[model samples]
Target: MNYQALFEQIKKKKSFLCVGLDSDMKKIPTHLLSSTDPVFEFNKAIVDATADYTVAYKPNVAFYECRGAVGWRSLEKTVIYIKDNYPDIFLIADAKRGDIGNTSKMYASAFLENMPFDSITVAPYMGEDSVTPFLEYDNKWVILLALTSNKGAFDFQFFEENNKKMFEKVLEKSQEWGTKENMMYVVGATKAEMLSDIRKIAPDHFLLVPGVGAQGGSLKEVAKYGMNQSCGLLVNSSRGIIFADTSDQFAIIAQIKAKELQKEMENLLIEYSIL
Candidate 1:
């Protein structure tokens, strides 16, 4: 989807929420295990339940890829279901893939061309060649990892080169390769305070923020600094929403959790005059 359509959905839904479908087989309700395509079934239920309160659905690829071939099949089924049923919802493949030139092109093609995701999370450690391949696709987004919420992010993301932090350089230099319309940065919600500085650099690009609920990232702080003119944030909650209740009513509980976030988001959008 293009940037205009994304903002349109956010306005229509009164939400900027992205539900994470990290549906681990071991974590889902046992009853779903009896189904032939347990993962897809679980995802379909979650999507149906929370579609009203969400503008996006992000599927963590590691959860499915870990299960092997069956897992891949389940992932495909889940993707097809979302594309067919909720064509307007922004679909993200949370596959942090980055490699050398040719290989990067293949990964980009696999997700952006074959699978039909609007965006895919990418790692930028290998520099321009590793990431630009993903940017070559029109209307496809490359969400590069920058200032993540994890503890280990401080190890390398802060490294200095020519007196600038590594992530600072990532934000500054990447603009030369892709416009805000096609490139975004993954700034974890836990780093909300730093967003003031980040916005100074990338001003208009959207941010895919994870680590909100289960990881204790504050929504208030994120909105305080991360939001731009179009409410440029897609806050994600994985285990907190999807695994809210591991029972027959799991999807219902997920909806409630999503609604709670949506309510908060609605208020923020209005406060920022984006509504």
Candidate 2:
């Protein structure tokens, strides 16, 4: 989906919540083990339950990739199910991939073509050539990593280059490769204070914000600094939503968790006058 369509969805639903499907086999409810495609089953239930309140669904690639071909198949089924049923739901493949030009193109095809995903997480350490290959797709997006929430992010993102933080430099430089239309950024919600710094550089770009739930990032702080006139934020919640319970009520509990966030987001959108 293009940025405009996504924004419209946010306005229509009064939500910019991206529900993370980090479904792990071991962590799923035991009842799902009886299903032929347990992983897909789990994701489908979560999607069905939360679709009304969410604008996006992100499947952390590692969960499916680790389970081998069966896991991969499960991932494909989940993607196809969402596309077929929830066609407007933005699907993100949380595969943080980046490499040389040729390799990056291959990775891009694997996610954006072979499998259908609206966007994928990308590491920017390899620079423009590694990142832009993913941007070649018309409506697909490359969510470049920036000011992440992890503690270790300080080790390198803070490095100075021409008196600018490394992530700031990444934000300034990558803007040349793709506009807000086909490119976005990963700014951890835990780093909300620095969002003013982030907005100064790329005020119009959408930010795919992780770390909102289990990672303890504050939604209020994120919207306070990160929101643009367009409500440019996709605040994601994973385990805290999907794994809210491990029983027959899993999907129901997940729905409640997502609704809580969506209600908060609705108020944020109103406060910013973007509703």
Candidate 3:
């Protein structure tokens, strides 16, 4: 989807929520094991339940890849199912892929061309060559890892040189290769305080924010600092929404959780004067 199309969805739904489909097989309810493809079945249910409240869905590729070829098939089926049914929903391959130019080109084609993902999370450490390949596809996005939510982020992301942090350099240098339309930065909700600084650098580009809910990232703080004129945020929640329950009513419970976040997002949009 294009930038305006995405903003339209956010306004239409009164939300910018992205549901993370971290569909780990072991975490799914045991009843689904009887199904032919438990992971896909679980994902189908979760997608159907949360579609009304979400503008995007991110499938963490590792969850599927770890299961081998069978897992890969399940991932493909899940992506196809979302696109076929919920065509407007932005689909993200949370693969965090970035390699040498040739390898990155293959990776980009594998996800952006072979599969119908709207975006893919990419590591920026390899610099322009590794990330530029993904930007080759029209209307597809490359979500570069910037200020992450994990504790380990402190090790390198904050390292300074001439008073500029590593992540700051990543954000600055990356802009030369991609624009707000085709590129976004991953800023974890846990680091909400740093958002104002991030906004100064990327005031208009969208931010794919994870680490809400289950990770204890405050929604209020995220909006207070990270929100922009276009509601440039896609706050994601995974375990706290999808895995809220493990029984037959999992989907129903998931819907409730999603709706709760959507309602809060609507209020945020209004408060920020972006609605």
On lDDT, who's better, 1 or 3? 3
Error of 3 at 195 (Å): 0.3
Screening candidate 1 with a backbone cut-off below 3 angstroms (N, C-alpha, C), the clashing residue pairs are none
What is candidate 2's lDDT per residue for 1-275, written digit by digit as tens? 99999999999999999998999999999999999999999999999999999999999999999999999999999999999999999999999999999999999999999888999999999998999899999899999998888999999999997789999999999999999998899998987999999999999999999999899899999999999998999999999999999999999999999999999999999999998
Q: Arrange candidates, best lDDT first.
A: 3, 2, 1
TM-score of each: 0.98, 0.98, 0.99
Q: Which candidate is the best by TM-score?
A: 3
The residue ranges of model 1 lying beyond 4 angstroms of the native Cα positions read none
- Model 1: residue 78 alpha-carbon error in angstroms: 0.7
Q: Which scores higher on TM-score, 2 or 3? A: 3
Q: Hey, what RMSD does candidate 3 come out at?
A: 0.6
